[model samples]
Target chain A: MKYIKVAGVVVFLLLWQLAGQINPGIYSSPTLVVTEIVRLFTEGGLLGLVFGTVATMLLGWAFAAVIGVFTGFLIGRYRLASLVLEPYLVALYSVPLIAVVPLLVIWFGIGQTFLLATIVVATGIMLVFPTAAGTRETVRVYDQVARAYCVSGRHFLFKVLLPGALPFIATGMRISVQRALMAVIVGQFLVGHPGLGTLLSDARVRLDADEVFAVALVALAVGAALTALVGWADRTLSAWRPEVTS
Target chain B: MTLAHGKTAAPTRLAALTGPGPVRDWTIRVAAFCALLLAWQLAAQNVSVAVLPTPRRVWEGMAGLLERGDLQLAWGQTAVQVAAGMLLSAVFGVVLGVLIGWFKPVDDAISPLLNAVFLMPRIALVPLIALWFGLQDTAKIALILSFSFFEIFFTVRNGVKTIENEFVEVAKAYCIPQWTVLRKVVLPAITPYVMTGLRLGLVYALVGVVLGGFFLESNGIGGLIYALGSDFRTAELIAALFTVMLVGLAVNLGLHRLENLLAPWKVTR
Candidate 1:
């Protein structure tokens, strides 16, 4: 199975190379993409672009986390709040946030603020559902235990509720991180912001397929790294969950 | 006895305040909505109309688009593209997902590739797709497909994986044919996932169609939005965005109803 997987990738690359040879304008082979990536790093200031996009993504994600978790906790803890807010949250969540980027650009202008707002708008609401669900579930399961222990108020919220909801919050974080990355890239691409997305758009304008592919590869790596980082955080934070549950 | 009755009354009142009731819920929803609108109105009054249009301006803008038939025309184009692309995605995604999930060799060869592609933001490929397909409905549909296909494919593939091996074993022992086993065992098990995929795919397809309108060609609501936004027509842009949001909410609610009807036992989020 392992050999077959390796062979499959090799064959896929070879076919791509062949295709690139035939239509070098549209198709970018693996080797060419690698070369372009190295050149981009060395001369194209790819690091700065990466930093710009990632920094915006992370900052926006942090804001989203705070807002989502707080709102989610409130709604989950209070039935009246949930009844009033859940529908709106669901509607906001379902709406393709990309649709609002243009509106955001107009409101915030085509720069870092716009980019940050886009990321927040795109990815923030996503965290709400999972966090709310997690909080609700935690209350349902542990409310009695906490009551029995004479726990209430902030002590209950911090020591009991939040800890119990960590897994769900972590899951939300992981998912939101992915959206954050996509949001920043697409935001920069649409607005011509100084990021990897701009690099991609520039390559597109030049009709540099190899450079586009290379930039896409860098984006993929960033996405993967963010996802992995979130996963790691989730695992580390939730390590105590099993012991508590048991 | 009077003191005990008073205590009971107090607790019951508290319970009523905290508990779910239809009348109270609707009242709260309406009140919250009004408050939100008021807040928006106040904020809009403070800001430039070009930056944040008042709710009334947005209403007027929507009416203007309606009068000019721009809203209907653009929405119609987007609807057609999204529907067509989603239909194709459902067909191809299910077939490919099933094949990959059920066959070991295919899964081994293709799963890694699929995962790699899945991790890459499909939005980043918009320009590349535009280059290949040009500014046509084909590009729009292709973009939609690229965005939506993975949700259905991955859902169905994982659904197939979750099918109990014992069921397949029992079918084999009973001499049931492979196709019958698939129909009876695999299909039933994965229907919930398919429903979920369709729900998710519809949302992603909306995103794709909007992106296509923005980047590829300006024919749909996305194009209308892009045009309005670039011109700083804030009122019209908000109206157009509201339209998209309504469509999304409607699709989400509609699919949820359909899923409940089709797969009542499977509660999906």
Candidate 2:
């Protein structure tokens, strides 16, 4: 059954090639996409494209993490603030991320570095709710014990709340990373920029289905790698459910 | 829906319920927003409408458009498109997801395929849909299907597959009809996952439809936004964005309420 499952993909590619031979205009062969992927790699253009978008996503994710953790800590620490802020965060997080791309593009210009900023704006707000909730929900006794020893702000943050709330931060971060990546892609897709998104856009404009598929494969690899990387980190750091809740 | 400012006062009382002060407690939840509005009003006194249009000017623009009946018509048209697309995705996504979940053979055959395909953003398939369906509402629907089908399927499949076997055995012992067992037991039990799937998947569908519309020339907000934004009419783009955000916010808030009612046990998740 495992072998059969792997064969499904191979069979799919073989069939795709056959389809291309029958009608080259619509279906692109896996061989061609693979060859294109190799070509894209050697040319170094694809690397830049992947990096550009990845950089933006990482920046936004970093921003979201810092702000989200701070807010989460605050919310976890105080009951009133959590109640007040949670509603708005939940309300805002539900909105479709794409709707803001245009406004972001308007505020920032189209193309170049503005696209990064646009991606940040689109995904930054998402981190606030989860982290704040994580913070608010952290155990108070840890804080009390720390206070009894006159724990410094930095010490208390690093020793008590941060470690205790690591699981929440990890979960929130995992959620935000996917969203931030999606926002970056969409921002680049619509707003147009120099990256894998732009490469994909170029493929579309030229109607190079094979090139588009190849570029998409690269993006998929990037997306999957990002997910797996952060996910592994989260799981490793926690090593148990107590650190990162599913 | 109306969780008014007064409800925020519960923290002082709920202190008996819990411990510790939240890290960033504040008097106002949206003070930054209010501050910005006030700043905008003050800045508008010196700014030109053509440049940085005042909040008042924007409000006037919104009012005038509504008064002229164009805004209402546009909103109505866009709302219908979004609603219809969302409904279609929800129905198809759930059905497809449930089928794959309920049947292990199908899940075995299709899960990896889907995992690979979903990694490629739905926007990757927009051109394929456009070529197949052309610049029509159908393209948007196709895009919606592509965006939504995978997420809902994954969630639902995981949901149903993860259930305890004891309940199924109990149902079998009682000789519950297969369909009744599905409806009465399976559906209710997986309702939490389905609700989560719907809530999340609809966002994907909404974005796919709207983004696809930018290139498809539909009469929806996406089309209007693309038209206006591409023209460098910042103010109009801002207006269109506000309208889009308003609708999105409304849908999300509405879903949160529905989720709370349907699955109160899943507040944190």
Candidate 3:
């Protein structure tokens, strides 16, 4: 498997280099993209852009997690409220929040505020259903135990429901992170704001495919790191399952 | 008998409309919607119309776009791209997914590369594609295909992995042909996963098409959105957004129906 992966990488790079050789201007070789990555870090505003993008994404993701989990909990707790709001929530969820970029731009202007808000709205809604469903399932599973113990409402929620639903909420948060990043980038692309998104837009306009790929490589790194972090968190949280039961 | 039945059915239909279950739910929904509209109208009165238009104004803007046929044309173009892209993704994803899922060597060879590609922000690759195909429908469609294919691939692959080996063993013991086993057992087992992929594929397909439209500056709803954004036509922009949301809802409901139709035994949530 290791050899297979290495061989796969080598073949991909060779094919790419070959393509670049055949069409020098149209495609960029791995070497060129690597150099571009170096140039970007040394000469371009790569650090600042990365910081800006990551900061916005993290902030938006944090806000989404809070709001989504809370709202989802309430919806889960109240069956009637869930039923009443199902249509609206589904409509909100179904629409790619990117589709409403124009509204964000109009309301918030083309800035970090716009990007952050867009990420929050877009990713927050995506998190809600998963969280709510997870909470509902967890609560349903524990309802009898809570009733037998005659746990107070607040105690039942905090002691029983929240911990039980944590895994589901985490799962939802994991899904939302990818989407939040997408929303942030798309907002930047649309607004022509500062970030990797703007860098991508500028590179494409210059027909500098190398730079585009270079920035994409950075994005891939960030995405992979975030996904890894989420995976680690998931494993760690699930470890708590045995502890909770005991 | 026909006339009697018609009369009874008509009254029951009317009663259903006025009944508590759907009727009360719909009433609350409409009230919520109206409350939202009222809030927006009030807020619009205080704020700059350019920034936040009144609900009435937005409705007019939508009506204008509908009358001018821009909304329909743009929506039609977007729908066509989404449909084409989704079809390609479904075909390729299912085939590749099944191949990799079934064969260990194939999976070992491909999973690493697929994982890397999947992690990359696909939207960022739009420019590279534009460099190849220009800002045309082909480029848009290709982007959508790339966006959607991996999602289906992963879902189908996982689904395949979870299929019980005993079923395949039993089929083999019964002297079932390899192809027959695949068609009868594997396909049915993975139908739910395929349906899920299809649903996610629909949303991602739209994302790809719209992102392409925004970046490539093509003639679709994204183009209309970009145009509206630039012109600062807030009302029309909101209207266009409303239309997109409606399309999203319609597609979602339609896909759910499709899922139920395809796999009647399993309930899809």
Q: How well does each candidate reproduce the native contacts, as fnat?
A: 0.68, 0.39, 0.65
Cα deviation of A218 in candidate 1 (Å)?
A: 1.8
Model 2 lDDT tens row, B1-269:
36555565555555633434442344244564576688987876775544456786677666665677655766676667666777876787688777777777677767777888776666666656654566577777777777877767778777778653736679989998877877888888788888888877777767776777665555676776676666655566666667766777777668778988989875434
TM-score (all chains, Cα) for each model: 0.92, 0.85, 0.89
Clashing pairs in 3: none
What tens digits encode model 3's per-residue C-alpha lDDT throughout A123-215? Answer: 888677777877888787899988998985899888988888887777787777778888888888878888978887887787677876787
The list of candidate 1 runs beyond 4 A from truth reads A144-151, A242-246, B1-20, B164-166, B267-269
Question: Predictions ranked by DockQ, top down?
Answer: 1, 3, 2
Cα deviation at A219, candidate 1, in Å, is: 1.6
Q: Name the best candidate (by lDDT).
A: 1
After the best TM-score superposition of candidate 3, give how far the Cα of residue B184 lies from its true spot, in angstroms.
4.6
Model 1 Cα lDDT, one tens digit per residue, B3-71: 555564444655554555665577778989999999999999999999988999999999999999999
| Model 2 chain A: ten consecutive residues of lowest lDDT | A132-141
Scored by TM against the true chain B, the candidates give 0.89, 0.79, 0.86
DockQ of each: 0.65, 0.41, 0.56
lDDT of 3 at A124: 86
lDDT of 2 by residue, A104-199 (tens): 665667765566666556666666665665565555547567778998678877887777777767776776666677777777777676676677
Question: What is the per-residue lDDT of model 3 for residues B1-269, given as tens digits with 9 covering 90 to 100?
Answer: 45555564444655655665667667777887788778888989998889888988999999999999989999999988888889999999999888788776778777888898798788878778777777788888889988999989998888777774757778878999877877889988889888988887887888787787788856789888878887889889989988888877888789888888887776433
Task: Give candidate 2's error at residue B196 in angstroms.
Answer: 3.3
What TM-score against the true chain A does chain A of each candidate get?
A: 0.92, 0.88, 0.91
